[model samples]
Target chain A: MSTVAVMNGNYAAATAARLARPEVIAAYPITPQTPVVEYLTLFAAEGSLSSRMTEVESEHSAMSILSGASLAGARCYTATSSQGLALMYEPYFRASTLRLPIVMNIVNREMISPQSVWGGPQDSLTLRDAGWIQIYVEDNQEILDQTIQAFRIAEDPRVLLPINVCYDGFYLSHMTERVEVPEQAEIDAFLPPYEAKHQILDPRKPMAIDPLTSGYLVMEYRKKHMDSMAAALGVVEETDKAYAALTGRSWGGALDLYRMEDAEYAVVTLGSVTGACREMVDEKRAAGVRIGLVKVRCLRPFPKAAVAAALARVKGFGVIDRNVSFGWNTGIVYQEVRSALYESGRTLPSVPFVGGLGGEDITLGLVSKAFDEIVAAVDAGRTPQSAVWLWAPRKGVKA
Target chain B: MSALDLLAEREDMISPGISACVGCNVELTLRTVMKVLGPNSILAIPPGCMGGVGVVGWNKQSGAKVPVFFPLLDNTASMLAGIRLALDAKGRDAHVVAFAGDGATVDAGFQALSGVAERGDRIIYICYDNEGYMNTGYQRSSSTSKGSWTSTTPVSKEGQGGKRQHGKDFPMIMAMHDVPYVATASPAYIPDLVRKVEEAMKVKEGLAYIHVYNPCLTGWGIRAEESISVARLAVKTRFFPLYEARNRKFKITVPVPNPLPLEDYTSRIKKFSHLGPERIAELKDLAEERYRFLEAVSAGGGGRA
Candidate 1:
């Protein structure tokens, strides 16, 4: 049994966490992500969720508190955005290294310096190698469903790693959409009661949880963590099927292919921008252009084989990134997509385009323009000259 | 509790073969604290000499028979608070403790410590005061006493090898939080420290804080044998007064009548050898000011109870 309601992404994520019934939730308030915390507090206050809510001083303390709770054998949760996520970097890495299956919602906001509160995937993509199983959500419905499934994948006996379910701030987090939230009974059946296998702070069986591993064993711990991530790659698919069997919905497991069959060229994207890409593909297809979209959902435990196989038949692909991997000039996803292609001996005329940054509108027009560049590059029989930056303000030219 | 009971705890709870140096007062404090905390204890040890020395190491056998968790240096209190709440939620009676040092408690970790106290978290926070950041090679911590020589406050000029800023009055600060229990114990006084730990373990209301005086031989430039003597002089001279605050009622646990001169305590440690008699008098004034403040707040109402 599930209820259909018009809700924002944060509310959907909060509903999922409530249904999942986390034992402990410690989070600090940050822009675009505060509503999730607020909603959880409402659940705790209204006698809905029995989760213990710990209001912390900073993002660092929030993660640290959750780490303690998770290691002590409890299902834990927390939420943060850009700077808040960066502030939690220390314990964020520790949470994964300690193998605590904590689920965090990162309402993706642009990283600052020229301070911005806008939506972007850069914040979560930057921590891809932090030993967290990161997945980007397409919309509010996906946000709700994936968060419930994330616990199942994260707490898997073979993959006791943290999960960062990222959804673009404001674009999806603040925007209301129709989300079908499953019943608590369905959630329980989907995500069984968390039983920790690795470590639990029990007095009867006393043992050090995170001990000082020697240099000799440091590699051993890292190997195990990485192997757990590899295991999660498989668990992500299996759990998505399980979640669909329970809820009648799936997040396309790892990567979502949008009309790529017999397509001449495709562009890779994730998050809300994927919505624009899908629209662009439809418009281009109606106009007799063979343009397609590949939404790389799981950035960590990256679907290299899945992506490679998806692109193996396609002729040319362009990567539309909302983030720029500085100095590398290419976008973060561009590097991974290119590697996936080269690994399978299938390098096409790939172009990396940076757009929709700092909440800038990544409209249907901009996505279509990126697809045009891919088509032109394929026709020219050459790769793009350089990475393209869209919707730039002309210097010294007013409006 | 009987002395035999405490001794039995020593034999049973404290694991041997730790690599701590001779006369490491923190090691003695840890061994005794663990005895009272028992097997049902889960210790969140932060980055400090007590945690790093012989208690835990690279693939080495842990010096704790009970569960030990290594949290970051500055977030021990909050970490232990999380562990405490988790155990509480599970209906488990595990006593979670944060074993930290002067640097971790007063300097880097002060914000987290204050956060835990403000949240009224139920955990025993034992700070083994070693004066400075001795774990990182005798660096000057905010708790490093005024006119104490640390590597960071080295002597650049002749006869000037001490920090000018006074160290934070941390225990009194904890008492100000009006926590369930706030006490100061000395490693030299095992039974008294044991009593404080037992009291803290019984606290189901909120936080319990114990600031134990553990003199560092390496940082203080004192010989190994001088550790206990130094600890004793610290209490006798009113430098480190033993006290407890419960329910906002304060008490001076160890009375110091006709206290020793400040130099009688400082002169033995080479780190304070650069301080002249005049500077020692200044330190004495500071110690007296703190003691007077504590006395004023005592439930005994001004003077020795």
Candidate 2:
């Protein structure tokens, strides 16, 4: 039996990790992601969490500790955000290359320059090529569900890679929502205990790991890693179906479509902004406009085929990215969507939308405005060369 | 049994031969230490002379009989701590150890090492301090002695400049962490070094740290045969004093009552040959001052200084 509880994203993440029963957990505190570590330690203190928890001094040591634990054939977990993610980049990249099945919750926070820390997917999106399978969630419920499924996907022999379950900070991390906490027995039945087969650190069976290797062998390892990532696409779908069978809830694998069928225009989104976009799609449909919503769940191992197929019938589409690509003059996901379309050999008129940076709210008004631009581009038979800014001038504030 | 006899009877954990300097005492220190740690150990060899010499090995082959790997240069201690936790989780008893160099210990890796000590993680950390980054063409590290000429701290053609700062007293720093055990060892004193390793292994709770002072032959420009003797002079002159601290209780392992003159040690090494009378006297006074502080700590019941 599962219990339905009202909690924030951090609590959901912590609850999911507890149910997964990781053998070792090491995490350092950071804004937005701080409460996840606190909750885990509290669980351990109360004797509910059986994992050997270590309070690491830095995110670098946190990831390093998990890497070592995973190398020793133990399931591991951790959480971080923004600057903390940047600090752990060394071990974070190595964790995936070493193919350790460590699950980390990235409570997505904005990277600092002028110093703002409300919410954004820029933290995880900037590291999309770091080899970890990244899954962005829409709400607290998905935060709990996907983090639980993350262990199964990462520990799968066909896809033995570290994974990141990323969700927008403050928007979901601090905001309360209904979450279904799965039974321990149910989660145990779903995610079997991780058993290392490829590499391990054990005195009984001595072997060297990450030795000085020739260029030829290094290339071979990289090819194998790529193959595993491609293989993970299938594993993700399979795990989603299996979880749905057990829990009667399924977050669409890779990409979640809302009223996408028989629709002419699509508003593509990721993370917490998907909720507002879904409402906007419904409102547009009620007003007799044929529009839909596409929420990108899995960013890495990018579901390129599914994305291209989903937009095949639509006259045009617009991607609403909360993070920018800097050089591309558009959001990161906009480029990704365009690249996937390019592979499909379909050149459709599309609009690029960039907004909601640094935890700024991506309100329904902004999402509806983005849909209008997509429709305008499609009807006019011309794609805009530059991104449309979803900006709203506040009272007494300059543009 | 004697340290030599104990070593002769025990199986050597390190592989027969790969590559090290002609007379590298760091290599000897590693071999002797691994023998004491034995097969029931998991070793972390970070980037250093040992790692560059293929201690972690080429391709898939291992450099030691026990499970060994190259940890990142700045994460050896934390990685070992993780290994210890996982091993304990499996109800398995094995010594989780790190054989790191001073560049990986006192410099970049210090924060992670300090974290492990404070957390009371049951792991043995052994740092082979050969003064500087010897494997990287003798670059100056925080562990490099003052007045020593490293590639990065080069002297002028007329023998003018060298390192400006004193080397960090790293073993004493670890002792202050109040970990289960902290000790300084030397390659010249095999018995004392062996006993320290034995003591580190006996520490079942918290961290056990052993810092070994080894004089580099190739990097420091010393004769291959004079490697062990030069290392001996370091201890004899009270420059790198041999001591141990159990839970902050200090004890000089090999007390040098009538210590040799600082020139007796510095005159033998080319790195320090450029030092004039004033510089050599400065080195002598610094060593004496450090020794006096150690003596006070030892006499004052070894609490916190």
Candidate 3:
């Protein structure tokens, strides 16, 4: 591994793409994600990279460029966040359906309803069905490390799906941190050149791509897509193990269960908030409370089984959601964990805590309060509801 | 001109079993474009006749020897820019051509096209102007010329519901970029079309625009065999002038003759058959007015940057 002095999340991502040597880099400047493309252009200008950078008018066009590039048998990369991802809605779905192994890094931010630009997982979660393999990173190091692993996981012949490596806006993207960038030869041996089982434009042979078909054909196509996605679970596992061997860092499967084995109470969350929750767990344990934390690294192909195993023995659970499902009463993660437990033929009274949305600071105190709620329920020998909103402020607290 | 003989011996680049409908002018347009671009080009096709005709299945391609990248309908220009970039990264310089129908070019794909051209990505953009959304079954498009009857522009009992807007002036728009090359040709004028394509291919930078006048036999209700003849008549009647804009200068390739009356152009196609005598006269006057403006431009200095 090589130590680059220091870099922001966006530049690190761009450097990762450069090291991976993607053939096509299509990007349009959007806030938070803009510096990624700008740095890529800098790399291109200095002749440090050989990839082509397309100046697209919008995020929609940026994704469309990757779709074409992917078909042409190029390892393609793009960057966007918030409304940019929303603008790319149509082709984003197409890229995943076609199962092109394009890699993209999304600096996650909240979508506009009341109209604000701040950080959250809402944008990437909203694209949950886009058939993209979504991985959330906790810090700049994870951002750089996961960006490299993402290409391996997505381009795995068994998977053949697009990947979105999500990091939080401003918090992770703009912040500087020390990251270990692996050697070019190390990446070369680990990831390998992208050789597709099928390419849209191979002159040696002829084929048809994207034919319009009847409803039944589309259904079968969807089934095949789902089957491929299901197949990706194994590919992701194998690639993570291989990555760990090469770097001495094992990012346990889709979800990482931290200290949940013997704990009576657990809290689950994604992204950098995992660090704060872990800290809260340490602090609560010093006070002699039996509490643990679960960090969901992969939000898509969600580790339902992993979560079930982690929470099977726990008495009470709380989910820290940095984003809320507008129409739902509780947090989105709470709904997923609840459904997973229900599907697994087990029950855990999980409280949903919504906080840190739109760049709001998710303090350890807030997380400690959630632990207090969960521990009180378990100690009182009372089962909480299937889910309850934990940190929603009361009317008097509003300032 | 001898290149036509060389092409004659080669099998038609677009294979016979492709999905283009029987007697569709797009078939000829595709054949002509493939011949001009040769076997080494990469085509960026979006939704419309060209896209439908080209892509058949995932990883399945048509008869063209070169690669064709089909992006979403509205993003042909941007995708072509990407294709050019991809090729450049490999140290391989090849033509990146965006071939889309009038609907894809003049409507949804407009903003992307504008961006790519302004960025001057090395791509050749061709709008096969068939004047309507023929693939989706004869719906109206921005390129549907005034007085044309389409499924959406049904002929009324009072005969007033033809296309309300004039066809968009794409060549003018391309010229506005002061691009290196912008030319208009028809399948009927094969030699001229081939010459323009050859010239555009030699240009190393910036965008090259070619607008091909493709006649719609099904939508326009003309004989399938008369597609070429109809396009030729369009040029002769000054309804579709043959011209080239290079470095922002417009040169009328086909000088206006004692230009044939609008009737000579309209009477042949059933689309314009709905026109009354008075409407025909109005159409004739509009065509002449457009011709005079173009002629004056040609006479003074043929637009040049």
Summarize candidate 3's per-residue lDDT along A1-399 as a digit string, tens digits: 766558888888988888888999889888889999899999999998888777778888888778867776788999899999999998899889888899999999988876768898899888887889898888887787788888988888778889999999988899898878888888889878887776555444444456555688778878887777777777777778998888877777688877876898888888978888889898998898878888888877777887888888888778888877767766677788888898889766667777777877777777778788777766676655433543447588752
Return the interface RMSD of the candidates, in order shown, one decimal each.
1.7, 0.7, 3.2
Model 2 TM-score? 0.98
Task: List TM-score (chain A only) for every prediction.
Answer: 0.98, 0.99, 0.94
Fnat of candidates, each listed: 0.62, 0.78, 0.50
**Which pairs clash (backbone N, Cα, C closer than 3 Å) in model 1?**
none
Per-residue alpha-carbon lDDT of candidate 1 for residues B12-39, written as tens digits (9 for 90 to 100): 5655767678878888888888878878
lDDT by residue (tens digit), candidate 2, B1-305:
79989899999898889599898899899999998888998999999999988888888787888888888999999998898888878888899999999999999999999999999999999999998898889999999988999999999989899999999999999999999899999999999999999999999899999999999998788999998999999999999888889986888877777899989999989999899999999988989988888887783443223
| Between candidates 1 and 2, the DockQ winner | 2
Question: Best candidate, TM-score-wise?
Answer: 2
- In model 3, the Cα lDDT at residue B71 comes to 65
**Candidate 1 per-residue C-alpha lDDT over A1-399 given as tens digits, one digit per residue, 9 for 90 to 100:** 888899999999999899888888999999989999999999899999898788888888999898888888989988899999998898899999999999999999999977899899889899999999999988999999899889999999999999999999999999998989888788887778898878877777777766666787888889999888888989999999988888889778999998998788898988988888888899999999988789999999998999999898877889988888998897899999988888999768888898888999888877778888889987787776557776657599453
Give the residue spans of candidate 3 off by over 4 A.
A213-221, A377-399, B19-22, B53-66, B277-286, B296-305
Once model 2 is optimally superposed onto the true structure by TM-score, how far is the C-alpha of residue A114 displaced, in angstroms?
Answer: 1.3
Q: Which candidate tops DockQ?
A: 2
Candidate with the greatest lDDT versus the true structure: 2
What C-alpha lDDT values do all the predictions have?
0.86, 0.92, 0.79
What DockQ does each prediction reach against the true complex? 0.66, 0.82, 0.45
Clashes of 1: 0
